[model samples]
Target chain A: MTSSKILPAMPLLAAGLVATPALAASVTITIPQVKVAEYHRPYVAGWLEPVGGGSARTVFVWYDVKKGGREPGTKWLADLRSWWRKGGNTMKLPANGVSGATRAPGSYTVPIPANLPAGQYVFKVEAARETGGRELVSVPFSVPAKGGSASGKTELGTITIR
Target chain B: MRFRTVLIAAAAASSALATPAMAHRQWLLPSTTTLAGTSEYVTVDAAVSNDLFYPDHVALDPAAVKVWAPDGSEGKVENPSKGRYRGTFDVAIDKPGTWKIGMERSMIGGTFKLNGEQWRVGGRRPPMAPGAARPSGAAPAGAAPAGAAPARAPGAPGSAGGQAGGQPMRMVASVAEIPAGATEVKLTESLSTYAIYVSADAPTKGVLTPTGKGLEFDPVTHPDALVSDEEAQFRFLVDGKPAAGVKVTLVPGGKKYREAEHAQELTTGADGMVRVKWPVAGMYWMSATTEDAKPSDKRASARRMTFGSTLEVVAP
Candidate 1:
C-alpha cells in the first residue's frame, strides 16, 4: 500500500523538474507572378522590422550588378527606396549578406531564423523597376510561446508564411 | 649724332610698315567632349576670336589646317566659313589614345604662326569612389587586406582592387566615332579581353585591334557599320502605355573598341541599352520584346513589357 502511494507522488515530482525550452519557428514568402520589361530586370528586397518604425534589418537582396564583367555601383541600391532606407542603407559591405543575381519571373523562398525572439514581427517586401516606380508589400505575423504560427496574404498579391 | 639719327629713322620706318597683322584664332570643339559609349559627328570648332574680327568678315582656309591622327591617316577641315569657322568631320578612332589635332594657321597676308598643345583624346574619365567594386577578369596589382577576401572572378561585380584601405581604381572605356566603311576595330581596355558584336550588316572580315586604352575594328565594308546617321526607333510599355525614344550612337565602334556593342536607345523608360552581337556582316532586323503571356484582375498580375526597334545592318 505504501509503495503505491509513493509512485503516485513520484509522477508529480517529475513534472515539476521538467524544463521547457523555447521552440523554433519559420516563415516563407512567395510571389505568384511578376512582369518585367526588356533590357530590364526586377530588383527585390525583403527584410524584418519592429512593430513600430525605425531601421529594419535586411533579409535578402537580388539584382544583376555586372553587365559583361563589371560591377554596377552600390549607389544604385538607393533606387529600391523602401528597403534601402529601412535595411540596405545601414549595411557596410553588402556583397554577402544582401546581394544576389537578378531574379526572373518566378517564386522565391526565404526561411526565418528559429532563434528569433518570440513576439510580434513584420515582413516587408519592395520591388522596384530599373526605369520607373516601385511596389511595396508587407505581412504581419506573431510567434507564440509554444511556437505557434500565424499567416496573412495581401491583395496586391499572395504571400504564404508559416 | 648721325648714327643715332639713322637708327631712329630706321626704327620709325619699320613701325610704319608693320600693319597690325591679321592672325586668326581657331578652336576645336568635339561634338561631345565626354561620351559614355558610341559617338558620331566630331565638331571641330574652328573659331576666330570675336575680338579680332567680325563674324562675317573672318574666313578660314580649309587647306590651311590639317588634322593628323596618331595613326598615319589624316583629314582636312570641311565647309570653312568666316569668323566662326566650324569643321564637321566624321571620325572613327578605334583605340583610346592621345589624338593630336594640331592646327597650323597658314595666313595668306600675315606671317603669324600658332601651334596648339596636343589635345589628349580618348582618355577615360576618372572612376567614381575608390570604395566602389572593380571588375574581375584581370587582377590589378597588390594583395587584399588582413581580413578582406580574395578578389572574385572576372565579371563578378563589386570586387575591390588595390592595397588594404586604398582607393580602388575603376576601369572605364573611352569611346570615339568612326566614319562608315573604315575597316579595323580596336580594343581600349588595358590587359583585358572584350567580346565584339557588330550589327547584323557589319562585315565579318572586320578585325579588332587592341591598343593602350581601348580596341578598334578595321576594314569595315558596310556603309552603316560605323556611322549612325539615320535615327532608329525603340518602343516599350511603361505602366501599360506605349513609349519610345530616338536612338543615338554615343560612342562609335571604331574608338575604344570593346568586343561588345554599347548603343543606347533613349526611350521613355530607363536608358534602353540592348546588347546584340554582330556575327557575319549582313542586313538583318533586331528588336527587343517584353510581354506577359498571362493577365489577372489584380494590378500586380499585369506584366510590364519592353521592346526594341528593328535595326538595319548594311554589310561593308
Candidate 2:
C-alpha cells in the first residue's frame, strides 16, 4: 500500500506516526522471463535475516492472493521453500502493506522497512515457479546502508537494495 | 515402432549397438523433491525401461524398496501397487529434514570351477524372443531372481543356473554351497543401491550420512537442494575410501521426447568427487559402478558395486 493512500485515511496523530521517512530504504526486484511449455508467474518472498543470529522479518510476499477457488494460491506459498523455512510459515495471510498480487516479468521497486536497528543484516529474496524452477539471492548490508545488489540466474534477475 | 526409432536414436550417442533395447535402465522418480507442510506425502514411480523415466518394460518390486526418515529411522511405504509397466508407492514424510527412499540389494554369485568344470551360480533369464510382448501370468511380478544383479532382481524368473547352450551350470545361493576342494574357483559379490531424496521443510544431513560400505553417494551439495545453474559436487566411496577413476554417468530424463540422450559421463577425481553442471532443470538419473578385489568376504575374490539415484534440479 502506498503511503499517499494511507496518509489521508489515518487521523492526525496516526498520520504523523505512519508518515514516510525522508530517506526510506527501497528494494528493486527483477522477475525474469522464462521460456517453457508451461510458465506460471513465480511466487516471490522477500525477508531479512540477521547476519549475526536472530529471527527473520518478512518484507513482502508477492503471489496470487485472489486466485479463485476453494484453495487459493496461498496453498503454494510453501513452494518458496527457503523463505517458508526462514520465517514465512509464521506470518498471517494478506499482511497489511506487505502482501500483494503477482507481477509480470519486469522490474519492481518497493520500499523496505526502515525500523531496523543499526546492525548488519542480510536481505533475502526467493522465487518459485510452478513446473519451472526456484531461485534465491541474498544481499548483505548494514542498517542505514547506502546500497547493495545481487543477481539470480533463472527464476529471478537482478536485485538492488538502496 | 516409433518408440523404437526414438530409443535407437537416443542411445546412438552412448552405445554402438543397433538395438539397445535389450539393456534396461532402472530408476525411481519421486513426485516432488522438496515440500513444505509438517506431514506431506511423496509418491514415487519405479521401473526398468528402455527410455529413462518412461515405464514400458517392467515394474520394480516394492518389497525391495525402503524409506529412511529424516531422523534416520525406518519409514513405511503407505500404499504400493505394481502395474504391468511400473510400480508406485507413497511415503508419508512427517519430519522437517530430508528423507531417503529406495532399494539396496546385494548377492554373492559368480563362476566357480570344480574338477575341470566351470559352473555359473547366479540366476539367469532366458533371452527374450525378438519383439516379444509382455509375458503372461506365469512369473511373479517384481521378484528378484536369487542369484543375479540385485538391481535387476525385479525381473521375471527364468532358467535358474540352467544350461542355455551346452554350458554346465548350478543354481546356488552362496559360495559355501560349492563342493569342498573346488580348484581355481572365482567368486564375485554384487551390490546395488538405488535411492531418491525428498525434503519436507529443509534439507538435512541425518539421512545423507555415508554407511562406508559398498557404493556411497556423498554430496558436497545437498541432493534435494540442487540447482541447474550451479555445479554440484558428489563423491563416490568404495569400502569407505575415496573411489578415484570411477566413471559416473548422468542422463537427463524425458528421453522419449528427445532425439539425443544428452548423457554426461564424468570420472571421479582423486578425492572421489565428480562435478555435474546440468544442462536443464528437470529430473535426472545418475549412476556409477566400480569393480575391485576388495570383497567383504573371503569366499569372494572380486566385488562389484553400483550406485544410482534420480534427482530433480531446479532452474536456478
Candidate 3:
C-alpha cells in the first residue's frame, strides 16, 4: 500500500531534479470545531522536524497577533507545549510567511519551506484552544517524494503533507 | 547498615501514613507556571495551612525561602512581605528556561541526660556546646504540643514509650550537652525541602537535578510543562538513587470550596516512578517523606527526609 503512493514521485527521484519548483510541497491542515461555553479559535502551529529529532523548520503559526493588551497574544504561545519546547520559544514572532492570525474552523493549505535538503521529516500540526482540548497530528513524509496524511481526534483534524 | 535500612524503611512507611492528619501542609504557590518572553517575573505565596494552598494557618518566613535560576546559580526574590496568613515574594526571570523557589532546612535532635532526667532536643534551637551546663530559666521555644511530642520516660531512653500528659518533655539544646557517661545516646537528623517551579520560556532541567541527599523529585516529565489529561512520570530519590515504595500524595487547591480533600495517593514502583494523571487543570500540592540509615553527620544515627512541591497543571 505504501509503495503505490511513492511510485508517482519515482520519476522525479530518478531525474534527480528534486529541488525544482515543480517538486515544491505544501501541507493541508484542518482545524476542528470544538463546542464549548466559551470557544476561542485554537492556536495552531505547523512545523517540519527531523524524524530522529534535531532543529525544526516552522511552516506557519496561527495565533493572537494583535491583541490590545500590554503583552501581545504571543504570551500564550507556550500553550502549544511541544512546538514551544522544540525551538518555537526562540522564534522572533511575525516572521515572514511563518506567522498568521488565528483561523476559524476550516481547512487551509500552507507551502512547505523550499530548498529543504532530502531527508526524512515529520510534519507536525498542533492545535490548542481556550476552554477546550489540545491535539497534535504528525504526517511522516520525505522531501522530493510522495506525501502522507494523519488525523487528530480533538482540537485538530486531518493533516496531509504532499 | 543493611538491617538498619530495612528498619528505617518500615518506620517511614508507617509514619508517612500518620503525618498528614496531624501536620500542616507547607507549599510555595507560584502565580504562573509557564511564560513566553525575553523575561518574565512570577510572584509566589508561601504558607502552612490545613488545606492545600489556603493560607489560614501561619505565614512561612520569607527569608527562609531561596531561589535557584535555570543555570543552577542562586537567584534573588524581591518585595518579600509576611502577612498574618501568608508570605509573598517576587522572582525576576531575567534568564530563560525554568527556575526553582523554595526552602531547605535541616535539624538534629537526640535524647540526652540532664540532672538524671532523660530529655529530648530538636526543632530550630541552636546546637549546644559540649560540656556546657543546660541553660537555667530559659524554656525551650517552639516546644511541640503535649500530644504531639513523642513521650519518653526518664532513664528509658531507647524504647518508644507511651504518652504522659502535661507541659511536654524538656528539649535540651543538643546531645553535646548530655553529661559525661550518659547511656543510650541517640541522635537523628532530618532534612525538609519545599519548592515550586516556574518557567520564563521553555523548561530546563538543571535546577531539577537532585542533590543526592534526602528525598527529592526527579521529574521524568518537566515540572513546568504538565497539562491535564496527560500522564506525567515522576521519580522519588533518596541519596541520589531511586527510592522505592515511598508514598506520594497529590491534593488539589481550592479545598475551601470542595467537600473532600480529593487527594490522589500513589506508591512508587520498584523503579521509583509514579505516573500522575490529573483530572483537571489546577494547582496541586505534592508531598512525600522517607527515612533512611544514611546520615551525612557522623554524630547522627538516622536521617529523615521530607519533600514537597506545588505544581500547576494547565488545560490542554
Better by TM-score, candidate 2 or 1? 2
The C-alpha interface RMSD of every prediction is 17.5, 4.1, 2.8
Chain A TM-scores of each predicted structure, in the order given, are 0.65, 0.84, 0.83
TM-score for chain B of all predictions:
0.22, 0.79, 0.79
Local distance difference test, per candidate? 0.35, 0.73, 0.74
Q: What order do you get sorting by DockQ, best first? A: 3, 2, 1
Write the residue-wise lDDT of candidate 2 on A15-105 in tens digits: 3465445346677789999988898899998888888899999888888878745456766887887787676766666788888888778
Error of 1 at A41 (Å): 2.7
lDDT string for model 3 (B138-217, tens) is 32343423332224333322222122232234454444333354656687887777888988776889999888877889
Please give, for residues A1-162, the per-residue lDDT of candidate 3 as tens digits: 011111223343476555646347877788877777799998999888988768998888888877745576887898788788676877888676678888888777776776888888999988989778778888999877668999999888888777
lDDT of 3: 0.74
Model 2: per-residue Cα lDDT over B17-50, one tens digit each = 1112335677789998877555568899988776
Off by over 4 Å in 2: A1-23, A27-42, A48-58, A62-75, A81-162, B1-23, B124-169
Maximum-lDDT candidate:
3
